[model samples]
Target chain A: MAHAADRRCVVIKADVHLAREGFTMDVQFQAEGSVLGVFGPSGAGKTTLINLIAGLEKPHRGSMALDQQTLFDAAQQIDVRTHQRRIGVVFQEHRLFPHYSVTGNLLYGARRENGDLDRVVTLLELSPLLDRRINQLSGGERQRIALGRALLSRPQLLLLDEPLASLDLRLRRQIIPYLRRVRDELRVPIVYVSHDLTEILQLTDQLLVLERGKSVGCGRYGEIVHTDAVLSVVHDRGMNNVLVARVLEHKAEDGVSVLEIGPREQGEPTGRLFAPLCAAEVGATVSISIRPWDIALAAAPVSGVSILNQVRGTVLRCTGHERRMLVDVNIGAPLIVEISRRSATTLHIEPGTPIVCLIKSHSVQFVGALGPGSPQ
Target chain B: MTPEEWSALLLSLRVALWSMAIMLVPGIACAALLARKKFPGKVILDAAIHLPLVLPPVVVGYVLLLSLGRHGWLGGWLYNSLGVEVAFTWKAAAIASAVMGFPLLVRAVRLAMELVDPRLEQAARTLGASPWRVFATITLPLALPGVLTGMVLAFARSLGEFGATITFAGNIEGATRTLPTAIYTYTQVPGGDGPAMRLMVISIALSFAALIASELCSRWLTRRIGAAL
Candidate 1:
């Protein structure tokens, strides 16, 4: 078994073209991230992409390879069976076998004499559920068992197709931590698919954006959001700038906490911003999500403002989407700020122009605590 | 009851049990094939399996005689090669009963197998189970209640079989005579009403018991599988 620290990044390359009734999915991309977030809205062929990758659906023409093994090749007629591909999939619904107990379902696909069972059971906290029947489990418990079952197969690549989509808000929060453990402890390469931008951002920054069965953008979230193709898909979806920040100090009297954000390299400039007081200890890392539209850009730092955060940075790029402009700023970190076009003209904002991003302390929502092994 | 009537009742039970045993494997096989597969002649196969149910039982018995009798085509080869006789014997009575009861067995089991969700089988396949393993583990168990219902139905039908058994095997006392055949024999004689009435009550009671047992078994199975839905 490969440990997290020694596991190399898995590379996935696919050039698929499939046409169904009223829908055609023609996407091509190569991703090398340990967890590549597949982001798009409904009917954007997100599920179809997952099916194609998992060998549940065949493409009309194209080839796909995962780390060196060819999963499918239309010309070569090298389509591997789903079971033989060793790719685990956790579908939106918890597809646990109703005829089996939780332990039976987990071991259904496990290799004989493989000792990963106990480790996986402990990792997902499945000891209490081992003897329970599928129908007896709650929705959250069922989804966790589904995840543990997939992991016990020891898949080379795990495909999560909106594993949290069917769960309620609180239940979704319950499963995200176990998913992080799977990512950070097991070190299995994952392709996390979801329409919720904030949910995907909590797992990984590398993204593959799909729109209407097409590859709109594929790269780091901060760099790809500047493109118009990506912006149009995520503009009204509550897209947020997810940052990894360290707790600096807490001002109990003011009921606010300060966090330092930006590159962690020595001597590099970092910005300080006030956020709502959180229970995390000082010096611990936490993920903060601030909606792009919640940010207001100014030409200069203004004094006596009610907004608690005024971080100055240079504009990297700016793009117009309908009546608004999405400005990318580098305040020791890349952040996408959505402001109206009127403000853009008033401030004479363009690439290379220095600007101040004014944000209220309440806008900074803590998504989750980042583990030390979590990718930035 | 006289020794002759006792033999008739015993023979009827033997014939019913034998018929059920003979048809169990092939009945479920045909039901599964009809419910799951799609071949070119599927419609024709389905129609043939159901022909005995709709046709006159006498006609079915005549057809069986033509194909499996001593001098018949298949029977002649069997007689010459293996020296085995099938017609006008107790075995012929069982065969006739099995053929007449086949349609009911297939109908019940097919409906049950069709109700077993295909998605569960697909999930099994993805979990590294082969097609045969999926059928054994998922499809067969889920369809068990229907299979039992079909078996009981076939067993009841076999016990009451008359027209086909008489035509194919003939009513020889202590050899091919069954409950209905013995009843017909009693009714044809003078002052035979008492014996005929006694056997009539027994047949009705046996059929009722078989039906009640089937209902109880089906209820238990439904409870086991209902939670999955």
Candidate 2:
């Protein structure tokens, strides 16, 4: 659908065919003014998708449009050159012009914005080190400058292809907040290419999980993060569940969340589920991640313990590996618990063991989801 | 040294400078083509570029003379269209020197272009720079050191070119004679040994200067790029 003479931000809509070094990808999706993450391993066409979006590579038989502009349409015989496409791209290495100072590299993109210099500089927070040479900056600082340069272009859309991959873990952590600020404050939509689930969780609302050059799953993180397809790749050797639980009340004395888990099934009682450090209000819903390892099994109702979660349930299955065991407990629903083989033998855990599972309230992590009422 | 030696040394410098200036563009263009693009007959093009390096200097000179002489095909067209005679002239001497030095220039430039990371160009493209803009703003600047090295090597080669210049441009004094031709002429004349020895010393100095200039240019370029980012 093409809109004429309208100022809606560019919406990426394309099916692309890219084949190189024995890998072939044919991906199609529509993205608007939200962070859409192309998540996959290296060589899974995540960066290729980004390059295609930025017009760095052409698709052989696909049609792509950004905003109302026709970028490429093999049938229509239209391919707007990269410079004319008004798309900003940042690479993993930053790729700052080696011949320019930090200011000059930033202005290289800023000057292309047609006189919106002040706005971009303000938005990306690039005022302090404007005069510094790019090579003189630290890895995190260089990435920030690179981000500022991309933003200065005032592009309809931005594509980031693993901008933090080259950084050490500490530097990566330092730059992540700035990435969020860009998403929050700027009007530009970003197509972030990353294989890191942590980045996907923190920075993006929408996701396209790629495997072998194909989109195996695509949805908001809430919808797909726990799905069989997403989980198969994400939790290959582990079992974790992200539950949309409401913080019913906080026991500050013990630092735990009395979370209301699951939906009201018309007749079922809404019981309190204990989570680690309740950070939300009494009625505020937060997606809490429960790792299987944080749960413990007890054959009886053990008292006089700091472990606040003592849920009564029947053991569905007990599977043991060389060092660890996966115990499936049906606490109204199936909850997976991971324990060491020593603990399994010590507790004498087995299938159909009517047991109480204990979870320390501080072990639950609060992570939100992209629901219908999510911020735009 | 003597007036004759000074004249020959000055003539060599002039011939090399002019020849280098003439071939710089073509050499860079060829190098860029070889580095960036591939097509049918690419191997053949590569071989053709290296022909001057493989061929004997005298054979190269004879080929130049056959094609650029007064009655030859290109020479006839030049004479008929522009009344310009190239063979047996200083211009022919410069052309011969450039031919001898062309391989050196092309090889240096091609190596430099190859070393330039192609990812930088792709980054430029994503920044909304056109192909030509990327070449001008990114590729050309990054490859300047290599181009300078090529130019110096070519100039040095041109300064010492003897067989090609003598065969194509002849040994006329102050007209077609360059340093190498003058040296050739002096060796033939009796009692010209002193002048010939002085010219040989001048040739060595000039080659050393060219090398130093190339080294300085490369270091400066490296520093400039390193300081910027």
User: What is residue B24's positional error in candidate 1, in angstroms?
Assistant: 3.2
State the displacement of the C-alpha of residue A267, model 2, in Å, after optimal TM-score superposition: 25
Alpha-carbon RMSD, each predicted model: 3.5, 7.7
Clash-forming residue pairs, model 2? A10-A67, A135-B229, A275-A361, A276-A361, A276-A362
Candidate 1 — which residues are off by over 4 angstroms?
A: A1-8, A246-271, A278-285, A312-314, A345-355, A369-376, B1-6
Give residue A43's lDDT in candidate 2 (0 to 100).
72
DockQ for each model: 0.45, 0.44
**Tens digits of per-residue lDDT for model 2 on A295-319?**
8888898989988778888887776
lDDT of every predicted structure (CA atoms): 0.87, 0.75
Predictions in order: chain A TM-score: 0.89, 0.67
DockQ of 2: 0.44
Could you say which candidate leads in TM-score? 1
Give the TM-score of each candidate: 0.90, 0.79
